[model samples]
Target: MPPRVLHFKSIYLNRSETFIDRLIRHLQRYDPIVATLFPKHYTENLPIYTPSGWWAWRRDCWLKQLNRTPRFLYGLCRRLQPALVHAHFGLDGYRLIGLARKTGLPLVVSFYGHDVSRLPDAAGWQRRYQRLALQGTRFIAATEAMKQQLLRLGFPETRIAVVRFGLDLHQFAFQARHQAGPRLLLVGRLVEKKGHAVALEAVARLHALGIEARLSCLGDGPLRNALKEKAQKLGIADRVLFYGEVTNEQVHDAYYTHDVLLVPSQTATDGDQEGLPNVLIEGLACGIPVIATRHAGIPELVQHESTGLLVPEGDAEALAAAILRLMETPGLVARLSYAGRLAVEQLHSLERMVGDVEAVYDDVLKCIP
Candidate 1:
């Protein structure tokens, strides 16, 4: 009989939704029983438990409720009796570890960037929760940098595996370049860490240089008003268009419609940085050249000058120069776009990610005896 795996995540929204949902669908191919913490409208063969109603609370109360989630999760695990429990982030892992200890089941945890960098600095219980989460389970780091952080936090090097997130190549196929005006796209939360300000500044500089380009901003967050103000102050608000929170299908369309994908991610005031934004891979997959910074896991996915151009974080001038170079060069975009698509197809395929995760699951299960 195939092994049964229960994947636990707090919220099935945005990127987490894409990752968990895709993993569940693929794992079904191996005949594994998939389970999640969030309840869905449809019961499509996957087991889901609507636990403790944590998703309904505000941020502070949510963290407080998460601190007391072990009892509820323990009951769910006992009822499901999964062969192994895989939690997507560290805090969820900490909760699962408590259940694992009670039921004697193996637990696997994945650490995405913000959980290790930003959450620990939030004070009080969040820091303690992260510490306990790191201490208890076999950890999966999304990047080598994250793996190093896990090791520094006292997890055994052998206990941590670096598994970068994967992309669906088919869904993001390369589209032929068209003369649809010189368009730049930024797709991510309008938060400080994502460096939307830097992107706006770069566009402002390009405009000052007499470059006529259209900028499209996708996604939304707290800094939306501030970013718009910044763009207007720079006298380029007319050229910059904010699309707000677009659906996944719209994101793919934006990628193909734009000339370049700009991801000027930086380490925020709280040390929050990206763990390889999916937009970079998705942009490249759509045959669009990218101009991103060498921050966090970005370099892991974008080969400098091969797949896309890289600039120093927060350096608007460098970003402007890269954008200008891509625009001025007639065929560089095509070359980089082709190379980027090939890179994603060869290395960042969803199948590759699921296979590595399955190996991790199998390894943890073997040590259970």
Candidate 2:
């Protein structure tokens, strides 16, 4: 019989999708029964959805709702009876760990930045719950740096594995540059951490320097209208195009049509940050040179001066300078584009990520017997 692995996540937002979806889509390759919480548009051959209310709470009700999740998750696991459970974030990890202890199934959890960093700061019980989650499950780190964070959090080194997120190389392969326009693309939520305001400020700087460039903003959030107002105030509204909440296919097309991908992410005031934005890897895979901030897990993917240019977080002037450098320098774009694509092909392919994940599953399963 094939091994069964249950995957758990809360909400299934378009921007929040990642390699987990890719793994679910290709589960037959690993012969595992993949299960997920939260409903999404169906993909053929993947396991059916198991509903969970882990992420439907507003800020005011989150604490009360979170307290009830462990019971709900335990009930879900009792019904599914899987060999192993993989939770996608630390909070979900806590819930799964509780279920694992109740059901005697092996459990694994992935830490994706904000959950580990910001969620732990909530209150005494939440902090204790975070520790409990880390203690009960095998931890999957997206970067070596994240692994170290887990170590410092008192997790046993033996229980942690560093497995960076991967990309579909076939989907994001390098293609010939087709457009003549200087297009700068930013693909992320229009929120404070994503630094859409920084991108707008940088574009304003570029306009002041008399550089003709168009900026395309993708993805949507609560701050979308505010960001648009900021762009108008900066007098670069005409140059900025807001293509909010685009599909994955549209995102791939944007990668090819644009000359450069800008990811000006910053550590938010509440300590939220980017956990290696998949779009950087996707853009690099599509052979588009990226200009991103030297923040969070980004440096692990973008080799400074090789794959793409890195500027200090929240520095619009430096961002503008980097963007101008990529636009003005002939042959530099081609060199960086080729190097970025090669880096993704060699280091960030889905095969490599899945292989690492399977190894972790094997180790966890061995511990079960």
Candidate 3:
């Protein structure tokens, strides 16, 4: 029988966290179950443990009021008998550090984007992370850039492993898009780091250049109103369509309808950055040409006119030019499309991610007597 691994996330499954679900679901060599502080209702199909309704209220009370570990969680860990605990984020790992010590289970923590870049800036987090770093058996980062952040956080160099989110090629099949006009797609939560405002400026610039390019933005966030206002002010609101949040199927289908995938991600004012946008990988897998900014792990994937076109982060003029270049040059688009698909196939397949993840688990388990 395969060894059981407990997957811990503060929130079981947010709509934007499908990648975490993929990791939990695609483990072939290990039995996986979820333990979240609050599990989403849609997660009923999975083997998960969470305090619901009044029980959850009581759990919060225990955590905040009495300042003690919830007996429910303590008991759940004992009952489930998982060989190791894999926490999804640095904050969640900090929350579970005490529990792991009490249960005497090896803990593996994954730092994706904001957790490594943004969380360290918070007051008291550095000290908290130092504790987690010392206690955690292994750490997973999405890129070498993120690994550097972990290194600065005092994580042992030997314990940190760089793992990319694997894209399922069969799910995101390549399709040659032969659209009438330039239909640009930006798929991410409307946020500072996502650079939605920059994308709007680029679209506005395209219009100013006499190119009638339409922009479709998928997903929504706190900046939704601000981004809509910015688009309206730019006078490109007529050409911009904000679909808010949509299902994964809708996003996949949107890729086929659009001409270019725009990933204008940047470092936020609060120091938040991207690990690597899965949309970039998904768009590349779909064989759509992508125009992204040179930020974080983005450059690691987009090799500037090789796999896809890249621009300086927060530079609207440069982004508009990249889009214009793609519009005027069909050969460039086709070349990028072919290379992008090939790159994702070789570097970011789900099979490869699962094998790498399980290999880490195997190494962590080997240390056990």
**Which lDDT values do the candidates have, in the order given?**
0.75, 0.76, 0.86
- Reference-based lDDT, residue 121, model 1: 66
Q: Where is model 3 more than 4 Å wrong at Cα?
A: 41-44, 60-70, 177-180
Q: What is the lDDT of residue 316 in candidate 1?
A: 90
Task: List model 3 lDDT by residue over 1-369, tens digit each.
Answer: 899998877677877677788888889999998876667734856898766578775765467333234456677788878889898888877777777789988989998899989989988889888888898899999988899989988999999998889977899988864322489899989889999999999989989978999999999999999888999999999999999988888999998888899999999999999999989999999999999999999888899979999899999999999998888888888888989999999889999889999999999999999
Which candidate number maximizes TM-score?
Answer: 3
Highest lDDT: give the candidate number: 3
What C-alpha lDDT does candidate 2 achieve relative to the native structure? 0.76
TM-score of each: 0.90, 0.90, 0.95
Instruction: Give the Cα error of residue 119 in candidate 1, in Å.
Output: 1.9
User: Mind giving the per-residue lDDT tens digits that candidate 2 earns over 1-369?
Assistant: 667787766654234566777765555434544444444644355655543544532421353256434344455566666678887777767755556766788778888778656676676636665466455658888887677666766677878888888787887768744222478999988778999999999999989989998999989898989998999999999999998888888988988888889999998888787788888999888888888989888888787888888999999999999888877775777778888888888888888888888888888887875
**Best-to-worst ranking by lDDT:** 3, 2, 1
| Number of the candidate with higher TM-score, 2 or 3 | 3
- Find the 10 residues in a row with the least total lDDT in model 1: 28-37
Off by over 4 Å in 2: 13-15, 28-37, 41-44, 49-64, 68-80, 176-181
The per-residue C-alpha lDDT of model 2 at residue 220 equals 88
Q: For model 1, state the Cα shift of residue 14 in Å.
A: 3.5
